[model samples]
Target chain A: MKADNAAIVRFENLTLGYNHHPAVHHLHGEVAPGTLLAIVGPNGAGKSTLLKGIAGELRPFQGTIHLHGVRKENIAYLTQQSTLDNTFPIVVQDFVAMGLWRHFGAFRRFDATAERRIAESLAAVGLTGLENRPIGQLSGGQLQRARFAHVMLQDSPLVLLDEPYSAIDANTVHDLAGLVRRWNTEGRTVISVLHDLEHVRSEYPETLLLAREVIARGPTEAVLTAENLKRARQLAEEQGELVGAPVCAADEDAEQAIHAHLGHKHG
Target chain B: MSLVDTLASVPVLSPFIEFAFMRRALAGCLALSLGATPIGVFLMLRRMSLAGDAISHAILPGAAIGYLLAGLSLPAMTIGGLVAGVAVALLAGGVARNSVIKEDASLATFYLISLSAGVLIISMRGSSVDLLHILFGSVLALDDTALLLLAAFASLSIVAIAAGLRLIVLECCDPAYLARISHLGAVAHYGFMALVVLNLIGGFHALGTLMAVGIMILPSAAARFWVQTIAPLILVAIALAFAGSVVGLLLSYYVDLPAGPAIVLTLGGLYLLSMIVGPLGPLVSRRRPRWHFTR
Candidate 1:
C-alpha cells in the first residue's frame, strides 16, 4: 500500500455490499489534503454507506480504502445520527476523555498531560466549562458539539462526518460549518455527507455527487450543474434508490419540466 | 435521637450488631453495593435493564453446580456463578451483535435456559428446599473469611472500573466513535461485562444470587432520577445503597425478617420515594426541566 501523496483518502474501484449484493458499485474518489469535500445525493444513494465503508464500520466488498498512504485507522469518523444513549449518566468531560483512551496503556491512568489535552479539545469545540456536566442533560445542539469535541480530541489528520447537521438548528449548522472550516484551515482533510445543497454550494469547494456510483466529483461550481443533477436523479431512479424518487418527483413537480423527456425515458 | 442513643436504646441489638457475623454481613453488603453500582450505571445507560435481570436469573445454574462441587464453599460457588454470569452475558451480547434479534429477547432466552438448567442441576444433586438460599440469599450467615474475600474483590472491581472510566462510558454511550478509533470498544465492552459478572459472583453470599443481583442494580436505577452526570449518579447510588444496608440490617434485627429480603425491600422503598421526589420519576421533575450544563 504505497502512500498516496498528501491525499487524506483514496478510494479506488470501491464496491460495498451486504452478502455479495452490491450497494455501491465501482466507486472511486480521492480527497486531497486540506480539502473539505461535501458528499451529496438523494437519500439511499449510498452517501452514508460510502462514509461507513471508509470509516471501517462496514467492510468493502471490493477495492481499497487508503488513508494518508496507510490503512484507514488513522482517520476519525462521526456518524449521521449521534447514536449515543442519552440516558447514560456521564459528564461531558468524561465523554471527551474517551478520545484519549487509545493512547493509554492497558493499566495506565490518565496523566496530567492527557487531562490538559482533553481540556484543550473541549475548548476547541466551545464546550470548555461544560465538561463537568452530565451528557444526558445536553440539548440537541449541545449533544452535537459534544460529538464534535470527541472527534477533535482524537486529533487525527482526516475527519469523516456522515450528515452532522440533520435535525440541528440553523445556528448549530453555522457553527458546525465554522468548525469544519477551522479544521480544514489547520490542514486537516474533511469528507462530510451533507443533504443541504446550499451549505454545499457556499462552504465546500469540492463535491462528490453519489448515486451508488460517482455521479460527479470536482469543484462544486463546475460539477453540480443542472445537467449533472438531472443525470444524478435519473441514475438514482434507475437504481430504484428510495431517496432518489422524491428528488425526481420534486424535479418533475417543481421545475418547469426542463428534463421531462429524459425523466420519462428513465422512468 | 443520635445514632449512638438509638444503638443504646436496644441493649439486645449490641451483641448482634457488634458480633463478627453481623459485621461481616454489613461489610459484605457495603462492598457488593459499591462493586455493582458501576454495572447498574452502565446497564441503565445502555438500555439493558432487562439484561441485568436476565443475568441475575441465569447464574443460578452456575451457583448450583458450584454448590455441588465444593459443597457450598463461598469461593467455589462464586467462581461457578461468575463463569455462568459471564457466559450468559457474552452469549446475549453475541446474539445481539450477530443476529437481528433485539437485545431483550436474547436476554430472556438466556435467562430462561440457564435458570431451568440450574434447577435441573439442583434436583439431580437431590438438593430440595435448600435452593431457597440461592434465590433469597445467605447474607446473614456470611462468615469472616467470605466477608474479607468479598471486600477484596469489591475493592478490585472499583479500582479497575475507575481506571477504565473513559473507555467504559464511551462504550456505553458513543460506541461509534470508539469503534472508529480502534479496538477500544471491543475491549471496554467485554472487560466491563466481565466485571459485572464478577460483581454478581462476589455478591452471591451477601444477598443470595437473586437479591444480590437486585441490590447491585436497583439502587443505581433509583439514583438516576436525582442526577444528570455520571459521577454524581454513581455517588448517589453508593449513598443509597449504604443507607439501604443500614436500614435493612436494623429492620431485620428488630422485625425478625430475613436480612436479604429486608435489604431489598429497603432499596425498593428508596426507589419508590425517589420516583416520587426525584427528577424524571413519575411525581417529580414533571413540572420543570432541570437545566444541566453540557460540554
Candidate 2:
C-alpha cells in the first residue's frame, strides 16, 4: 500500500504485538480524511489491536503510525462495551460527562456550557431522561447508546469504534450508524470494526479486510470479495492454533502461516 | 424515672461519656470509619475486595519488623507497614502486568508469604499477650499519640478522596476510556492504592490487621444492597460503619467482649441484615420474573 499525502492516517510498515509475537505485521496503508472505513475480518485478525494502536493504548512493535493534521489526544476511541464495568455505581450522567475530560480536565468544575453539551449528547443518543439512572440498571442496548452518547460528547475529529454493533439491537445499530454517517458528513474521520458485512457494504464506502495481515483495502465492493473472505477465514483458522497456545513452536507456525498467506496473495 | 432521664441514663451512652479510654476508642473507630470505609467501597466496586484482605495481611510482616526494630513505636511500625503494604501492591501489579499470573493470584501468593513471615517474626521474640495485641488490637487502650495518628489519617483520606473523586470514578467505571483520554487512569489507580495503604495502617491501629479489612469491606458490601449511585453508596457505607463502631463499643462495655472483634461482628450483622431487607436484596427485589400465557 502506498502513502497518500492527502491521507489522515498513514500506517508505514506497522507491526503491533504482545510478548514479541505480532498481531498486525508489516501493514502499510493510508486512510483519507473524513472517510467512513469498516475494518472487516475474522476473529484474531488484529482488528481491535489496530484500533488500540491508533488509540495509543498499545504502542507499535515496529515502524510508525503517522496521524496527519490531528494530535493523538484529539482521537476519540469507543472501546468494546464488555471492557466497561456495568456494575459500577455510576449514574449515566456522570459516566457520559467523562467525555468532557479533555476540555475540563480531572479537577475542573462542569459549568453551564458543559452541562448543556452533556444534555445535548444524551438527547442525541435518545437518552434524554435517563441521566440519573445508574448504569448498572441499563439494558445492554441502552448501555451501548449511553457509550455512543459519551463518544458524541468527545467531539473529536477522529472517531474509532471497535465492534459497536455487536450484541446491540437493530434499532440501536441503525441509530448509531446514522450518527456515524453524521460524524463523517461533519468532516470527522470514522473507522469502525464491524462484523455485519451487509451493513458495511450498504453503509461504508471504504473497507480494510484483514487476517493477521491486510488481505485487501480500497472500495468496500472491491475489497470484500468472496475469494478474499475465504482466504481470510483460512488464514484465521491456521492462526487459531497460536492463540493462547504455549509460546514455543506455535509462534513460528503463525509467522509461517502469515508469510504463506501474504505470499499467496502477492504471487 | 421520666422517659428523657431514662434515655439519657442508658448504659450505651454512659461508658462513652464517663471513661476516657472509651472516649478515645470511640474517636479512633469513628476516624477509621471516615477514612477506611470509603476505600473499601472502591475495593468492592473494583472486585478487589479480596485484594484488600490480602493487602491487610501483607502489612503484618512490615509492622512486625517495625516492632522488632523500634519496640512498639507507632511511627516506626506505621512507616514499616506502609512500605511493606505498598511494596506488595506494586509487586503484585508488576507481576500481573509482566507475566501470565493474574492480579488475584499474585496478590494471594504475596499476602500468604507476608502473613507467614510476620507470624514467624512475632512468635520469635514477642510474648503471647503481645501477639494478641498485634492480632486483635488495643482500641480501648488508645493513647494521645494513637488518637492523633488516626485523626491525621482521617483528614488526609478525606482530602485525597475529595481531590481525586472524578478521576477515581472514571477509572473504576471505565478504565479503558480514561486511559485513551488522559494519563489519569494510572494516576487514579496508584493514588487510590496509596489511600488504601494509608487507611490500612489506620485500621490496623484501631481493629488489628485481621479485622481491619472487615471494617473496610463489610459496610461497602452492605451499602451495595441499599444504594444505586456512588455518592449515596459511599455515604451509607460510612454511616453503617460509624453506627457499627458505636454499637460495638457499647456492646463491648456492657457484655465484656473484645472490642475489635465486636465491631467486626456488628458490621457483619449489618451486612447480613442488608442482604435480606435492603433495596436490591433478594427478599426486597425478586430477581426472577413471573410468567403469564395469553391465548
Candidate 3:
C-alpha cells in the first residue's frame, strides 16, 4: 500500500504462475529508479516470469505489480532471444524500427527524423551497413547486436531484458553489456535475467537471487554469497515438479514467514 | 487475318472473351486471389498454413447447413460458412489458451469433426451431385450473386488488411513485443481471424471448401521460396494466385477438367517448381556441405 516516488517497480505479495501454479510466489519487493539490477537464479526459478509480470505480459496470480509513476508505455522489454523466430521475413532496419511503435503508433510514416534515429541506433550497435539485410541472414553475434539496436530505439526509462546473452559470442556479449551499462549511466532502470555470476558481479550493482522465491535481494556482493546460492539451488530442488496453484497450507506458511522476514528487514 | 485478329483469335483469350461463364469464373477467381492470397502469406509466415486448411474444412458443415436451409442461396451459404469458420477459429484459440493442447492440434481436432459432420449432413438430404458441387465447387457456374459476394469480401479484406498492416505484422512476427506496447496484439489476432473467415467464405464460393485453402496457401508457400520480406511476399503470392486462376481456367476450358482442381493443381505445380529453382530453394541453395571420399 505504500507507494514510494523513488521506486520504478513495486511487487506486493506478488505470485505469478500459469494455470494457478506459481512460478514466482509471494514476492514482495520494490525496484528503485536508475538501479541496474541483475535477477539470477537456477532454471525454472521464475526469472523470466518476473520480467513478464513487470512488462504486463503476465498478470500476477495473487497480488499487484505496480509500475510506480511510469505508464506501461514507458517500459521496454526485450524477451529472451530464443523466443524470436529468426526465419521471419523482416529486414534489420524494419525490425529495429518496430521499437518506435509507441512514438508513432500503427499508421504514422517513419519520416526523416525517425530514419536518422534508426541509423544512429544501428551505428551505435556497429550494424550500420547491414540495415537492409534480412535478420535471418545475420550471425548469432550480429543478431544480438541488432537486437541491442532495437533496444536503443525503444529508449524507455524502465528496461527489462531476459536472457539477452544466451547463445551469443563473448565479443557480442561484451559489446551489448556495454550498452546496458550506458543505459544505466543515462539513469534508466534496467533489470536483466543473467546466468553469468561473474558478469553480474562486475557490471550490475544490485542483484536479486530467486529460486521460485526471493532468496536474497540486495547489493551484488552480499546477495550472491555462496550460502545464498546454495540455498537457492536447494530450494529449487525441493520445489521440484510441483509448480501450481497455492492450494497447499505448507506453501502459505512459508509465504507468511517470508513476508514477515521481508517486513522486518525493511522496517 | 491481321496480326490483331490472329492474336485475338487465340484460344486462350478467346474462351474468356467468348463465354460468359468463363468471364464470371475469371472475375470470381481474381477477387479471391487478391483477397485471400495475402492472408495466406501471413498464415504461412506465422507457421499456420495448416490452420488455413483446417479452417477451410471447418467451413464445409456451415455451408451444408446453409444449403439445407436455403437450397443454394448465396447469402445463406456465405453467412453459414463465415459463422462456421469464425467459430472454429475462436474455439481453437480458446482451447489453446486454456488447455495443454496447442493451437494446431486443437484446430486439427475441430476441423476433422466439422468435415465429418458436413459429409454426414450432405449425405442425409442432398444428392451425390449436390455433394460433389459443394466439395469441388461450381466456378464455371458462378452467377451474379456469387460474384457480387466475392467482390464485396475482397474489398473489405483489402481495406482491413491495409489499415492494420503494422499491427498484423507485429502480431505475427513478435507478439510479445506487441503485447508489451498495447492490447492490439489481441485485437490484431482476432481481427486477422475475422478476415481469414471472410476470405475463406469468398474462396469457398469459388473453389469449394475442400480446395479453397489451396488457392490461399499454395501461392503463399511458393512465394516464400522467392521473397525474403513480407511486402514482396504478399505481392508475389497475389500474382501467383491470379496466374494460377487464369491458367487453370484455360486448361479446364481446353481439356474438360474440373476448374477448382485445375487451379489448385496449377498452384501446386508452381510451388514444386519454386522449390527446385527459386533462390534459397532446396535445389538452388545447398544447405548441406558436399561429402567426398579422399585417399
Candidate 4:
C-alpha cells in the first residue's frame, strides 16, 4: 500500500498473534480517509484481531501500524464484547460525559460546557429524554445507543467499532448507521467489524475479508465474493471440529451455524 | 427510664459528651467511613473489589513490620504500610498483565501471601495482645496519635478520590480507549489502590484489618443501591458512612458492643433498605400495576 495523506490508517505486513502462536500473518492494508470500511470474515478468521491491531488494543508482532502518517493516537475504539457492570450505577448522561475525560485534567470537574456537549451527544444518538435514567434501566438497543452516544461525545476523527450493531434492535441498527453515515459525510473515517454480510453489502461501500489472514481486501463487491464466502465457511467448519481452543474470530455464532449460515445478504 | 432517657443513654450518644475517649472514638468512626466509602465505590465499579480487599488484608504484614521496625509511631508505620501496599498492588498488576492468571486470582494470592507473612513477623517480634490490637483493633483505647493518623488518612483519601474522580470513572467504564490515548487507566488503578491502602492503614487502630474491609466495602455497596451516577454514588456513600458511624458509635457506647460490628450492621441495614426501596431494581419496583381501593 502506498502511503498518502488521504490515508487514515495503514498496516504494513501486520501479523497479530499471542506470544509465539500466530493468528494472522503478513497482512497489508490501508483505510482511506472519509470512508467506511467493513471487516468481514468467518469464525477464527482474525477479523476482530485485525481491528484490535488497528485500534492499538493488540500490537502486531512483525508489522507496522501507522495512523495519520504518524504513530496511532487520537483514535477511538469500541470493543466487540463488553461486560459492563450493568449492576453499575451510572446515568446515561454521566456515561456519555466520560468520553470527554481525556481532555480534562485529573482534578477538573465537568463544567457547563462539557455538560452541554454530553447533552448534544445524547440527543445526537436519540437518547435525549433518557439522560438521567440509569444505564442498567436501558434495553440492549438503548444501551448500545448510549454507548454510541458516548463515542459521539468523544469527537474523534477516527472511529473503530467491533460489531456495533450486534444484539441491537433493527431500529437501533438503523439509527446507528444513520449516525455513522452522517459522520462519514462529515469526513470522519469509520472502520467496523460487521457479522452481517447484508449490512456490509447494503450499508458499507468498502470491506476486508479475512480468515486468520487477508483472504481479500477492497470494495465490498470485490472482497465479499463467493470464493471469500466459501473460505470463511471452511474456516467456520474447521473451528467447530476443534474444541477447548481459543478461537477469537467469529466464534460467537458457531453454535447457531444453521441460522448463521443462511445468507441474510439478499434479505 | 423513659423512652427519651433510654435513647439518650444509648452508647452512641452517651459517648459524645461524657468521655473524651468515646468522643474521639465516635470521631474516628465517622472519619473512617468518610475515608473508605468513596474508595470502595470506585473499586467496586472497576471490578477490582477483591483487589481492594486483598490490598486491605495485605497491609497487615506491612503494619506489623512497621511496628517491629519503628515501634508504635504513626508516621513510620504509615510509610511502611504504604510501601508494602504499593508493592503488592504493582506485583498483582504485573502478574495480571503478564501471566494468564486473572486479576482477582492474582490479588487473592497476593493477599494471602502478604497477610501470612505479616502474622509471622508479628509473632516473632511482639506479644499476642499487640498482634490482636494490630489485626483486630482495640477501638476502646485509642490514643491522640491514633486519632491524628486516622484524621490524616481520612483527609488524604477524600482529596485523592476527589482529584481522581473523573479519571477513575472513565477508566472503569472504558479502559480500552484510555489505554489507547493516555496512561489514565493504569495510573488511576494504582493511585486508587494506594489511597485504599492508606485508608486501611489509617483505620488499622480503630477497626483492625478484618473489620476495616467491612467499613470500606459495605457502605459503598449500600450506597450503590441508591444512585445512578458516580458523583451521587460517592455523595450517598459518604452520607451512609456518616450515618452508620453515628448510629453504630451510639449503639456501641450505650450497649457495650464493638464499634466495628455496630457500624457494619448499620450499613447492612441501609443495604437492606436500599434493596427494598431502590428505584432501579425489579425487586424494589416490580413492573406490575397496582390498583388502589378508596383511601
Judge candidate 4 at residue B261 and give its lDDT: 74
Per-candidate iRMS values, in order, are: 2.6, 1.1, 1.3, 2.5
Candidate 3 Cα errors over 4 Å, as ranges:
A1-5, A18-21, A24-26, A61-63, A212-215, A225-267, B1-4, B100-102, B287-295
Write the residue-wise lDDT of candidate 4 on B1-295 in tens digits: 8775776586445557667877787778778878887888887787777887787777788887888987766677667777887788788889998999988789889888988998898888889987777777766677888888888889988887777777777678766666676766778877777787888777777877666777777778777767767888888888888887777777777677877677678877877887777774457556534334455
Residue runs of model 1 more than 4 Å from their true location after superposition = A1-6, A69-71, A100-129, A242-267, B1-7, B10-18, B126-129, B289-295
* lDDT of every predicted structure (CA atoms): 0.78, 0.87, 0.88, 0.77
lDDT of 3 by residue, A42-157 (tens): 99999999998998878776778988767886688888854567899999999999988888788898899999999999988889899889999899889888888888898888
Which candidate do you rate higher for lDDT, 2 or 4?
Answer: 2
Per-residue CA lDDT of model 4 for A1-267, tens digit only, reads: 123456788777667777656677667878787778888887667777777887777766566887884345556678777635575677887777767856664567778898888888888888999988888878989999988887777667788899998889899999999999988887778889889999899989998887776778888999888988898778657766422124335332333443454555444
Residue B271 lDDT, candidate 1, scale 0-100 = 90
User: Could you give the DockQ of candidate 1?
Assistant: 0.45
Ranking by DockQ: 2, 3, 1, 4
Task: Select the stronger candidate by lDDT from 3 and 4.
Answer: 3
Candidate 2: residue B65 lDDT (0-100): 94
Every candidate's chain B TM-score: 0.90, 0.94, 0.94, 0.87
lDDT score, residue A187, model 1? 76
Using Cα atoms, each model's DockQ against the true complex is 0.45, 0.67, 0.64, 0.41
Best lDDT among the predictions, by candidate number: 3
- Candidates 3 and 4, the one with greater TM-score: 3
Q: Candidate 2's residue-wise lDDT over B1-295, tens digit each?
A: 8765666587777787678899999999989989999999998988889888888898999999998888778888898899999998788889989999998899889988998998888888888787778777889999999899999988998899998899888888778777777877887999899989889989898888888899999999999999988889999999999999999998998999999999999999999999998978887778534234353
After superposing candidate 4, which stretches have Cα over 4 Å from the reference? A1-5, A69-71, A105-113, A231-267, B1-12, B69-71, B100-105, B113-116, B269-295
